[model samples]
Target: MTMQSLGDVVGNLVDGIGNERYWRGGKIAEPGVYAGVDIERYHHDPDLFDGFSISSSGLRALLRRPAEYWWSSPYNPSSQEPESKPALDFGKAAHMLLLGEDGFAGQYSLRPATYTDSKGDEKPWNGNATSCKDWLAQQAKAGRTVITETDIAHIRHMADALSRKEAIRLGILNGKIERSIFHKDRDIWLKSRPDVIPISSGDFVDLKTAASVDDETLSRAIFAHGYHVQAGLLRVIVREILGPDAFTSFTFVFVEKAPPYDVRVMQLKDADIDIGERQARQGLKLLRECLRRQEWPGYDGFDQHISYIEMPSWAKTRIDNELNAEAA
Candidate 1:
């Protein structure tokens, strides 16, 4: 018998999920603003519309890598489970705590620093130990996600920092949280879930966790993480669902995860939204064509022609400076 490599094992897992269609039960979600949809259901249920629907994140993937988008989409046959990251996990926990969700104790548990062994001896909790593994399994069976005690404390501090900001506090207090919105535009199904929507005020707010909220870093992050795309998509969805006159402003509330837990609030300008919306529309067009042909292409995309390479601007500048020094 041939032993399967780790890559093969992972590949098989992905194939299994894809074949199962992520077990969404094939129910079609109607296009509208959903107030109480579970976050899990919103993420996993790809048949939310009559056909495959694209979220802001999906659009970003489609724009950057069509093949990646195909595999990451729960509606596609090649879809795979997204890999979890520590930072993402931490951010999720923070969101749950800060978003006015009740019963935090029911959803999350902190791993005890020490556990009593069967022999009645106290030992530090070793994750690799069989007893520790069993303990974690029990937590899972109890329907509680396990997190570090330190993380719990950090989340509390982050929340406190946000509460100190007058605009953030008022915005959240006056808004609905985690609303799922689905709309059809130009024969394409699109979805968005804004973190907070102050309908009365016509202001929308999104929460983001970051390492730094400095101007330069946040500006880079906005483009790098396709936040502009997200903003653009939300604008379209909100306008379609509510009305052109309903949306007055869109803001992002960013909080640091570490010490001091600084907070910053920035609202997108009209020009920024325009740019983001244009990019989103372009991505949707590309996605429509790929879906129709059932052909998701990677960066190379069946192109076999040899391509010439150009030196990077920084490298070229360095070489020129060196040549000038030699002449001097």
Candidate 2:
């Protein structure tokens, strides 16, 4: 969109991803979005903006706490590591089952021996068994994901629950899935891949697997995971590619990762989207500044002064009441 050739875009964003591992096979019918794009490739694609993505998670990691971001992000040479593989695996499985349609089975295998151990006793299968490991290696070789039987059950339960929702069902049954969309705005690269983008409607949905979707737990999860920022990013990217009227509404479908697999569907308010957009902008500005200076400064470098540590009001109230009772 910004007049860069496809080669330039690929060159800029191709640092981490090797040449052989391109977005293997999927193609999109949509006008602007790209299908079958790998997560890493989209993040690093140069077509968006100089091969840098102001991702929601990256922004949160950097702005929420610079020191942590420096340690975790690959941008830092001293302490770079991949994210939790188990969690990523679980989510990947869930997405495949919920959105990937027929291809989900090919990408995953359930451990047949996970139900028991050496003593033939029932165990949760920590994925450490030698046989399990060997099977997983084979799955990897075959370009498939290895998962525990329990993982299959959990994902299945969530899938069943999702099918009960007419709106979600129709969207999934009728729409496109897992297309990576990008937009360049103000010299910044932004991208979003909604779990489900209905071809027939102007609404998009993001599926989230969590501990619980109750009001309190979900709200905390939203804030902690920067779901608001993600919502804004997704909306903005979609709006740019499709049009201002493209994303009339956004929804979050939350399902418990554990038993009962309770599900909740939420539509974010306009105010929530606004707040997220604001945070995303701030994060992008900071990212631009950091890249331009070629320095990723930590928090200690900025405000190292020992500031006042305010106690929680609830804790203070409890302390005061206990002291009064003791005096009485």
Candidate 3:
């Protein structure tokens, strides 16, 4: 068991994520079995790489395309703008914030571009080495217990499964009558908007980050805000792309960064879920509309029209009625 200081591990791999190029001045030229399409070939014909061919087309070419295109290109920033709101950007999330995930129903979904340069040294979602070191220094000054991955792993002598207990409870205590997970199959016409379709379990599992958390505080807050809407949108998109087998539940695992690195699992209920679904549907519609209008939603700037809608009354009413019926 290797228990080095938290300062040692992590923040080293994705330490400088915001950079346009690899963190290291030189390419992360590690000779390993990296699974991905050849970038050189992608340059000529992105389709050969997969569905991302159109999405990955050169910059100048995309600029000539129309505004209604849902896919993004080098110069044509069709996706959310950098100045956009605090919504999760998978690339930025993985590189800037460790909050983004992929791989399985709810594992880590890393893009090929990112995985190509990765070395497993740093974690970006939590910020890079600079932010992490600064936070660590602050923690050290306060005399709090520092539990780095190495320390935790050594103490428990277990490999990465941090949420083992909860997983067992979900799988064993609860009869997962059905469960499903999937990745978004990227294409030129469409983007990678993948999500898991839990046949049951009553919710769509969402992931998020927090500076710190206990247990109880996690449940109430996300009711107001979190990435649940994103999950809901993913649900709707998955249903649209795959078929109608969307998830029935919405779970959020808000991982804290403070001492203890505690994780809070909150099962979104009636109102919480209602809001997400409402927004999910709305956002999807809005995104397409925006694409058609060639007007991307701006996060940094305000939208006077959007502010008029207060969580949607119809959705809330339906949610309340459902809760009342369930209780009855």
Candidate 4:
């Protein structure tokens, strides 16, 4: 046989060694910016990219409940689909109306208030009737989410409220919407899908639907939902894909879902973002270890050690004050 050239031999070796080797069981084989990915595919497709990856929401799950994260991860052999929530569906519909090109009309259909009966008489669609059920099933089969007319009206009002905000309007006008970005951070792969990325200005905006945008309530919600951690992770991914100085700012645009739809815009403080980054790094490290050993521990952790629970400081102070009043 004729001797093969060095280049040919290398090519053969590379072909023999597939991208699977890079996956290392659960890590992504390739990482970079992925643009124009459909939101549904990006969120629902387990094998969208080359291999397993984690988004900001996944990172939040990993931090809060690794077991849940593992159960939901596509990389897991016995992973289960998450149950749908009406609130989440509403949010998605709002996002479609606000961010999607085709709008909610393409992905959602409004359930008629009434349906024609066998006698051609109009009857209220109570959603329990056989015809209504069949109609809903048909909508599902047609890959459309069924929403009430009120939902459509509320979403439209929320969109209208957001439109009046000059800053939000400008950002949406200048930015790319629903772009997915993937980057390998050391051992594990990270993924991010920002709501809006104004490439030239390097400003990013995340849209949120909330019950209240009042300072106190919104502040608590931000911490409770770990929005800061999401902000941190997104900033890192944005900077990694675009140069070091590419990320200029991140803003959260919150809109109330009820009538009179109020809107509020908040920019995260650098200090809070720094804290979020640290927390994100911690979560990533924990994730790497968990994946390496295939051990997913819940909030209680794997230890058999006892956990101590304590009363709140406010409660303790209240009790002390009552005792002093009784003694006096």
Candidate 5:
């Protein structure tokens, strides 16, 4: 679940309610912004490994086509031709589970998680023939343990956190609130619909869950990318919602949730805002290159306009073997 606010969750657990909201969802056209790392890896086309032909103009043209234009929207891809590119499949994969909580269409395709045996042997748990109960029936038949309803609820909660907005709040605020004032009338939006309005904290809050937390490195980057770019966008929205004082300051909450939660509070200044705007323009240049090519977003983006990120020269370096081979 994505968190929007940072309230004390340690001892004041009873009095203070953490109004958590995730900013990663809703109506954003930017790919990978809302994508789960696992889902992004799963949906990416592995066959487009040849790299780009004209990586500059081709990519630029592709980005421009969709600023407010039409691209092919696939309806049903499994029945389509091989070269047609399973876009319908991609869209369906992204959104299918969002509409239903108990949906298990992806189950048949998913490989079982690795587990240990009773005798203390580790093995893979997939491609088996088993008939157990409903959820654990297959696992039991494969010499695996039966899963509890509580455990299943956890997995469902996790997937919803990744895919649906409804899961966002549930995953973030679970085992905490028994009755929430945020929802009256028996959780109408919470119960009836499969989604909720994308969360808004009325301010920017950036929380980083990592192994070892560093507040300094985090603030610099957040001030550079997350706060500055989003602040320009947020200023307009916040102004409309709560008037002009909303733009008076930029608020950032960075929380490192490991064994203990260490929270840091910081703000972005006018200079940092300038850096973010410059970076956004650099990003848009890459987007423009993508537009020119009609190429879809994929893992092999390094071949194109990603800002020559590590292109600066070092003091001393080994020869470029690939470049040498080409010359030879």
Candidate 6:
């Protein structure tokens, strides 16, 4: 008998969910390759890896606070209350409309107007609103997609605007969407799900709902969110899993959550990705070291050291300009 590959071992474990082979009908399946399953399965499964999945978001967390990462990561075998995030819900709805297989029908239902308030606002009637809300919750609990009619409209507006962009439309003409890929190196399991992976071009695209897509605003947002890290790491992982022919470049399609629903397809050039790769490398090295030591420290001797807060560059630049003006 030959030893199974790590990917096969993981896949078998996940496949045993709700069966006698593993947890004996456990509600949540283990982490592994699940073909012909809802994409949500990959997103909600907490038991996907014995150690840490080291996601791009998790990389950011590791960079921020190692102790928090250690305590909250799957390796700790601890749990936390699943709090509802309205922003995340809204983003999921947008993702459903933009990338999911069923488009709108798979995620939402309609309700009729039921009651008129004293302020003259008519709410959905016949308990329809409540019913829809309950259904949405149920769908989410089942690891299925769900959304609102208002969210649908918002998505349509963004789609229409995006369609107007000839280059982007051409780039996204035919590609895979919402496919989760994982790479395990030693104890570290790196995972990424590109929103869209272009087939022939080998370029991936991620959809994001943001407040603004302006040059400066989006640039700052990208930096603040560590999206570059995500982009760089995802490219490397996809290549590692699927091979060098699988990933070449990355792009982010940013859509405004409100109003005219402006859409911007921002492509990170080699230069930007180079910086991201450096950051990712640093985070990965730190993560590996912390995991090996099993001691997640906070702020590297922060208790003993006295640190000074420095003025931000933008503020310092403004101050310098004002001082120079005064001298003139």
TM, every model: 0.82, 0.73, 0.38, 0.81, 0.33, 0.69
Better candidate number, 1 or 3, judged by TM-score: 1
For residue 136, give model 3's deviation from the true position in Å.
20
For model 1, how does the per-residue alpha-carbon lDDT over 1-328 read when each residue is reduced to its tens digit?
A: 3545545533443332233222234454456666556666667676556766888988998888798888877877667867767788788889878887656787778899998788989999888877899989998789677889899889889989998998765655455565667788867778887776553455567888999989999999988988988988888887676655445567888999998899988887878888999999999988888878888888865464778789999999999999999999
- Which ranges in model 6 have alpha carbons more than 4 Å from their true place? 1-41, 44-46, 68-72, 81-83, 102-148, 171-173, 298-328
Give the per-residue lDDT of model 2 (tens digit) for 1-328. Answer: 3444444433322321121122454422223466667665445333433445555667777778666666765445567544548877898788777776556666677667444566777765566776556766788789676777778888888888887877666563455665666677666556676776655556567888887778999888888888888888777777677655566667888888887788788887879888988888777877777778767777654555866778899999999999999999
RMSD (Å) per prediction: 12.9, 8.3, 18.0, 9.8, 15.0, 8.3
Sort by lDDT, best first: what order? 1, 4, 2, 6, 3, 5
Give per-residue CA lDDT, model 5, range 70-184, as digits (tens).
2222211322222422333332332333334233443323334554555666665533423112335564355333333333443354343333433234432223211111111
Query: In model 5, where do residues sit more than 4 Å from their true spots?
Result: 1-203, 219-227, 236-246, 281-328
Q: How well does candidate 4 match the true structure in TM-score terms? A: 0.81
Report the error of model 4 at residue 53, Å. 0.6
Model 3: ten consecutive residues of lowest lDDT = 13-22
Off by over 4 Å in 3: 1-164, 168-203, 214-226, 241-246, 297-328
lDDT of 3: 0.37
Question: If ranked by TM-score, best first, what sequence of candidates would result?
Answer: 1, 4, 2, 6, 3, 5
Cα lDDT computed for each candidate against the true fold: 0.77, 0.68, 0.37, 0.75, 0.34, 0.65
Encode model 6's per-residue lDDT on 116-217: one tens digit a residue. 555666766433455545655677675454445676677788778777877666766356554556667566777776675555555677888888888999
Best model per TM-score: 1
Candidate 4 CA-lDDT value: 0.75
- Winner on lDDT (2 vs 6): 2
